[model samples]
Target: METQIAFAFDSAQVANRFLNALKSSGIDNLKAKLFRGSEKVIVSYCYEDKGFDQTAATLDDLASRYDGCEISIR
Candidate 1:
């Protein structure tokens, strides 16, 4: 099964940094994309169920570092 997480960050710059940090962690079978809004950037992440916990934790850690970052699982 595949799991998905959607969330928002303060800005596209923050979103980019988040994605870069995520990719740098070297997780496999991961996919992510970002959508820009006037004020906030929305990010959608998808990965295998096997890696869901680790990926979610990584996202939580990364999100904490940025302002107005929050994860909304769907």
Candidate 2:
């Protein structure tokens, strides 16, 4: 039951921060594909069952920390 998670950020810096957090969170088999554009950062990951909960929490924290940064979990 792997879930697809995508988080789009407002900037590369925020994206980097989020990537760091994800890495530090100990989620195995994670990947940060393309960090394109100065205003958009897209990160995608495959999780083994109900991992969206963790991703959502982290995204919420990121949103709170960085103002104007949009985090989309889908």
Candidate 3:
């Protein structure tokens, strides 16, 4: 049961900040892979979850922690 969360941030700094927060939260089986576009930073992570509810909760938690940071989950 691997879950993936992809985040779009305004800049690399925001991406790094999000990464740090995710790491600090002690989330298990979490992976953040980065992609660079012309004007945006993409971060994708894979986690183990049985349902999207748990994953959404985690995503929301990070979104709240980051405040202005933009995030997406799938």
Local distance difference test, per candidate? Answer: 0.61, 0.55, 0.57
C-alpha lDDT of residue 2 in model 3: 54
Most lDDT-accurate candidate: 1
lDDT of 3 by residue, 3-64 (tens): 55456666667767777777777766566656454223343445445454465477666755
Q: Give the Å shift of residue 20 in candidate 1.
A: 1.3
Deviating ranges (above 4 Å) for candidate 3 = 38-53, 67-74
Q: Supply the TM-score for candidate 1.
A: 0.63
Full ranking by TM-score = 1, 3, 2
Per-residue error for 6 in candidate 1, Å, reads 1.3
Per-residue lDDT for 1-74 in model 2, tens only? 44444555667786667667766766566665434444444545554463335764565565457543444543
Candidate 1 wrong stretches, greater than 4 Å: 36-52, 71-74
lDDT of 2 at 24: 72
Cα error, candidate 1, residue 73 (Å):
6.5
Q: Is candidate 1 or candidate 2 better by TM-score?
A: 1
